[model samples]
Target: MELLKLHLIALFLLPTSTLGFNKCNFPAIFNFGDSNSDTGGLSAAFGQAPPPNGATFFHSPSGRYCDGRLLIDFIAESVGLPYLDAFLDSMGTNFRHGCNFATAGSTIRRQNTTIWQSGYSPISLDVQYLQFSDFITRSQNFREKGVFQNLFPEEDYFSRALYTFDIGQNDLTAGYKLNMSTEEVKAYVPDVLGQLSHVIKLIYGQGGRTVWVHNTGPVGCLPYVMDRFLVTAAQIDKHGCSSPYNDVSQYFNLKLRELVLQLREELPAAAITYVDVYAVKYSLISQAKKLGFENPFVACCGHGGKYNYNRFIKCGSKTVVNGTETVLAVSCKDPSTRISWDGTHFTEAANRWIFDQVVGGAFSDPPVSLKFACNKMNTSQK
Candidate 1:
């Protein structure tokens, strides 16, 4: 009788997430950020992501930087929603499941140089929000006009849809590129996060109630950072990643988490989930062998360097080899065993693995699964 009573108590103490009644019925997902989630914003504005970019799944350039799908693709699939169409992409677009406002090379704070000069996108975070603002009106107009009605989302979906953000990595790298020290980069994090919080408030003003924010990943482990930056032997961590860069990334995440907490108080109606992508990514890179992956720091597709990365000429760049025209930096025969596709981006396999790790809220603040991220937590999640 005592054993039966204890089992009943345990059953009653189960979290609400296990209950089907508490699961969110999010009809759509609106994503915003940089290349990590950029479906095709940059491609639509400039040009298509060339061949070998989406060779794994799409079998063609599907406007993503990775070899196949991204974490956003997995997130959408988890919720039974279709892949999000880029807001900037006008061709064959359907916004019924919301749109992606992310573009490669984007930064929270606008850069001083042009894309050609600094490799940063002209479309900053604020610009993306503006595009989103315009999209809200434009989609409604198209719906009312009785033209392209099927391509537009329902008017009420905006309020209930999950607003996801996975940016701020560029902001950290931008500072490093400008020759800023770790302390200098840390100094300006507040401003960068201020802009991020401002945008969240803007979304809140737009009646968005559910917000999902992914903290930046391990920037130190990226091949581009390792090859581009001069790192001393002592700076390399056990995983062969630059410790300084990763420290800066962790600091940025710390500040970002604080900002998210402050925003939670600032917007009582919103349920904001701060995802620790840094921890998840770092764990994968650190334990690559055990998890069945190659050297985590090496680029799967690149021309040269210890990391197989060349910043000047990226993947898919064309060159002449032995008097014949050839495509430079083609993908490896097997990308599933690799962690990085390009020097800067994760492979589809790595993305899928990362998604699997965090899908159950293992790395989320307030300890809520994506389905229940909208519910406000009264205490810190385990």
Candidate 2:
């Protein structure tokens, strides 16, 4: 009788929702994009990201480009799932939750014709889909063989999981690198969004019913671009960002939102929501003082410049300046108080703040809270 009483007490003390039984209804989360959402994907692929990159949180390089966790990490944690492991790092990976297919320098375009940058990305959106297919096949085979039966999800896991996309920034950056005019870059939006829509439709066809897509953030505020273009005070916006770049970002976002509406109509069974990451990001810059950020424009990890950002001496590099060897990407004394990380990405603190705003439902279309979106039923045609 005493033991029974103890067991009852223990049950009451336990959290309502346990691991693998999330209240949000999402059994897993699969992500695809570039550096913004990449955890260790780039490092696993090219072995490029190194030290001080993950200093603020992991205290060691975790292959994330920022000082800490990205927005995707926060989202995974919010939904009661483990951090999504990079697909390239297949060893010891726990795919029962989800997988990350983002690469640091990846672009949506398959060919280099649209991308001005050199080299080829083996894991483009199309390639990431292929990887997902392979994973599905392997898991099915394992299940059929009755191996780790309880370790994997049911046969319809993809339809129940959340599919997220945070791409397109790299393509725009490439266009700028090639010295394309604003009009020329704007013209490229249709092609980029078309590819993105194609991927979304493909996922839907493959049983993905809930998709959350983040629009491109304000690239104008990145110290990398501001340092290069905002030579005069007049060129900077009130928020200390490059107006030209922000304008381009705004244009892209407008078109992306429109596309989301179209997708919603076409895929009535799918919960296709657009997340306004740009507004959340820009808010941090515009309200830096209120947000407790001492330096909103300067990069937390960079070298030798007004904003401490040098394209040649990017973060995690070393260079000799004036006969003295200096670490190119030295971190600031307090990364938590800063906004930008390496001129392009946010500090972990900033990312956390952004996540808080995004999950609140105000920044999402159809006004569905992130938690609700995850838990909602899929209306996609069977």
User: What is the per-residue lDDT of model 1 for residues 242-317, given as tens digits with 9 covering 90 to 100?
Assistant: 9999999999998888988889889989889888889889888988888899998888888888888998879898
Please identify model 1 stretches exceeding 4 Å from their true place.
1-21, 321-323
For model 2, where is the 10-residue window of minimal lDDT? 13-22
- All candidates: CA RMSD in angstroms? 4.6, 8.9
lDDT of 2 at 88: 83
Quality of model 1 by C-alpha lDDT: 0.88
Clashing pairs in 1: none
Q: Which regions of candidate 2 fall more than 4 Å away from where they truly are? A: 1-23, 111-122, 147-153, 229-232, 319-326, 374-382
List TM-scores for all candidates, in order: 0.94, 0.87
TM-score of 2: 0.87
* Model 2 lDDT, residue 200, Cα: 91
